[model samples]
Target: MSLGEAFRTAVYKEPVMVWSLMIYGVGISYAAFVKPSMIEPHSKDLPSAPPSLKEVMAGIQAKLNNK
Candidate 1:
């Protein structure tokens, strides 16, 4: 069979494989073409660390007192 016929048969037999390959291709294309700046965060400021357990308990206690 010709290349096109073989490809069609493979697609019919393994649809999931074909779909995975298509998705991988799209992802690769996007990464290759898109600028790094577009993908990365624009802000230079880093996120603050999570609140400590003590801080969390204090907030919970404050809420209980308010209620």
Candidate 2:
């Protein structure tokens, strides 16, 4: 069988595999290209350090108190 026909048959028989491969390809493409471009403009906006446990707990406590 021609390669095209073989590929079509394989895809038809294993649709889930084909779909998963397509999703994986898209994810890799996004990570390699789209994600970097998206993140670059916002890099400065990101916090340099994570919040401390005390800060997080205080925020949570404030929220609870407000409710």
Highest TM-score against the true fold, candidate? 2
Task: List runs of model 1 lying over 4 Å from the truth.
Answer: 35-67
Superposition-based RMSD of candidate 2 using all C-alpha atoms, in angstroms: 6.1
- Give the runs in model 2 whose Cα sits over 4 Å from its true position: 1-6, 45-67
The whole-model C-alpha lDDT of candidate 2 against the native structure comes to: 0.95
Candidate 1: worst 10 consecutive residues by lDDT?
Answer: 39-48
State how far residue 44 of model 1 sits from its true place (Å): 9.0
Q: Write one digit per residue (lDDT tens) for candidate 2, span 1-67.
A: 9999989987999898899999999999999999899989898988999999999999999999999
Backbone clash total for model 2 is 0
Per-residue alpha-carbon lDDT of model 1 for 20-50, expressed as tens digits?
Answer: 9999999988888775666567544655677
TM-score per candidate, chains pooled: 0.45, 0.52
